[model samples]
Target: MYYEDPILKLEDFSLNIGNTKILKNLDLDIYPGEIILLYGPRNSGKSSLLRSFVHLNEELYNNVEGVGGIYFLGKSVFDLDRKYLRSQITYSDPTFVENLNFLTLKEILNLSLGLKLKDISKEYFSILEKLGISKIFSDLDNLKEYNSLKNWSIGEKISLITFISLARRPKVFIFDSILDHLDDFLLEDVKDILYRIKEDRTLIISTRNFSLFSDIAERVVFLDDGKISFAGKTESFIINYPK
Candidate 1:
């Protein structure tokens, strides 16, 4: 489902940190609902580029050169309200953690929707059931609200973090190697959610594991040493890789 109009565009984008040139003259045009895979070895600037979009590193953000423009739904990312714009674009990673220990998954999700509890009981349970988290987290009735984030297991912590991002209904989701720890069943479930979301949103993921999503992604962009070496259909990546 390629958008005739691109939702995100970066032209001649470049970034530098502490006198090191990270990204050099990068250009990318992506449409909504299209799956873009960034395949590269370690330290190839894949994660750095993703972070630039979300404005995570202030050093990179301040020292960035060129346009480095990002358009979300035809509006400049810098033009949108910080909070509202952030909700439209979520940057996720399996190891990505800020804080989620004090609250349960339910509380975090509610917070994403303005922290309102009204008219949420039904929708909340329905999502939990679909994500296969109802059992472990238990039903909402048995759960207690959290006041802080601390002592969350790896799986529980990641799942809840992802749930918060999804609840925002972002139009574009950028993930950095999120499938690192997912098992087969859980991977498929996450894929199902992405596919459902792809019906209306664009998903960009960076991964070194190609086998995990062979038939799921539409296109793969190979990056090496901060440069785009190849861009083509997902099925053609291996065949195109130098032997």
Candidate 2:
């Protein structure tokens, strides 16, 4: 008999921000091509743990301390280059846009790839078509937006952020659903996109809504007060989900 190794592994992992303890000695193994629905209440360290995977928390927070090992493909996360690791294990948070030149529809969409819109516009729209938001623009000229995000709908921003993250072509995708304002249709589109790609990549979606993306989550890991209260198959998760 043979067994496969987990793509990502957390061994007795813990995190601290300033004087606050965020994650408490977490241990889990994430296999490749797995769709993991990571959920918890607000400030339960979902974002902190996700950021830790790419080591984003250390750069943004001055008083951050993390212990234990976070490994990707048997390599210590600390041993890898931050930029390269980030590109490979992308963490997409809708509200936290890094180095934003201008939060235009075009620029936001092109945030990850950094290629001219003309070159990838055809490929871009095809991806958007799957998410049902492709009808907003017919050509590259329609990509400009001067008002940051004030003029655009919340749904549009969410969709574009989701798409931008996917364009990175990462091995592991960690998405933070910041703007929970998207309608049902958009959520379905996002779910479809995730399901379509899960065969080749690993996905971890952090959401407050239990019902959101439940259909695609093969496994559910629940975090409570920075501790994993439940980690099991989605079917058993329903029976064993912490109250």
Candidate 3:
């Protein structure tokens, strides 16, 4: 399905970190329910650009200076409350999963909704089954005993993080350099989950593994030295920037 309305817009967006320029004159529009792939080598500003959308927190904007503006659902991102913006536009990275070690899978799942374990709906269990993590749920007691994401495999960590993100049901989801960490099987599962959930929300992912998502993403935004070097359909990007 095609969405005509723009869900996010960047107007002459530029970012500078100390003496270095990260992004330059970026003007882009993101449509709702569209899957966008942001790809480039390291330091191309893919992560920085993704972080800009939820820059209400000082941690993201501390060392950076943005000249232009970023608008989400027609409002400037800077004007939105930090917590509100974070709830609306969720950002997930590998490190995000590491922090979940303190909480059990049930607690982590209910974290976003502020629901008690007993209060969690049956739908949550249904989602866990659909994601093929019913085994993990069944072993919830044992898994909780680990008490640290450090004990889990990379695939398990990513899967759990993806599940938590989906449970949030945010309008926009941002993933940073996460696809490269998964094995082929886990990658396929993650992609399947993304496909099912993306029908209602926008997905912006940054990864060096461009070919993995080439067929799934509607648009591809290639960054070079902090500026968008190419922005168009997935096929066009592959053709023009041939790996």
Worst 10 residues of 3 by lDDT: 131-140
Query: Model 2 off-target regions past 4 Å?
Result: 97-101, 109-111, 144-150
Clash-forming residue pairs, model 1: 101-149, 101-150, 102-148, 102-149, 102-150
For each candidate in turn, the TM-score is: 0.83, 0.89, 0.90
Q: TM-score of predicted model 1?
A: 0.83
Please give the clash total of every predicted structure, in order.
Answer: 5, 0, 0
TM-score order of candidates, best first?
3, 2, 1
Cα TM-score of candidate 2: 0.89
CA lDDT scores, all candidates in order? 0.70, 0.79, 0.79
lDDT of 1: 0.70
**Sort order, lDDT high to low:** 3, 2, 1
Query: Could you tell me which residue pairs clash in candidate 3?
Result: none
Per residue, candidate 3 scores C-alpha lDDT tens digits across 1-243 of: 444768899999998877678889999999888899999998898888888888832484557788887999999988889789889998987677667677665566556676554554678767666555656555458556544556776677777677667788899999887767888876777788788788779999899888888878999999988889998998887778888
Worst 10 residues of 2 by lDDT: 139-148
Q: In angstroms, give how far residue 16 of model 2 lies from its true place.
A: 1.4
Candidate 1 lDDT over 165-219, as tens digits, reads 6777788888788765666776777778877779678888888777776567888
Question: Global CA lDDT of candidate 3, please?
Answer: 0.79
**On residues 20-89, what C-alpha lDDT tens digit does candidate 2 reach at each position?**
9999999999998899988889988888989999989988898999899999999999999988898888
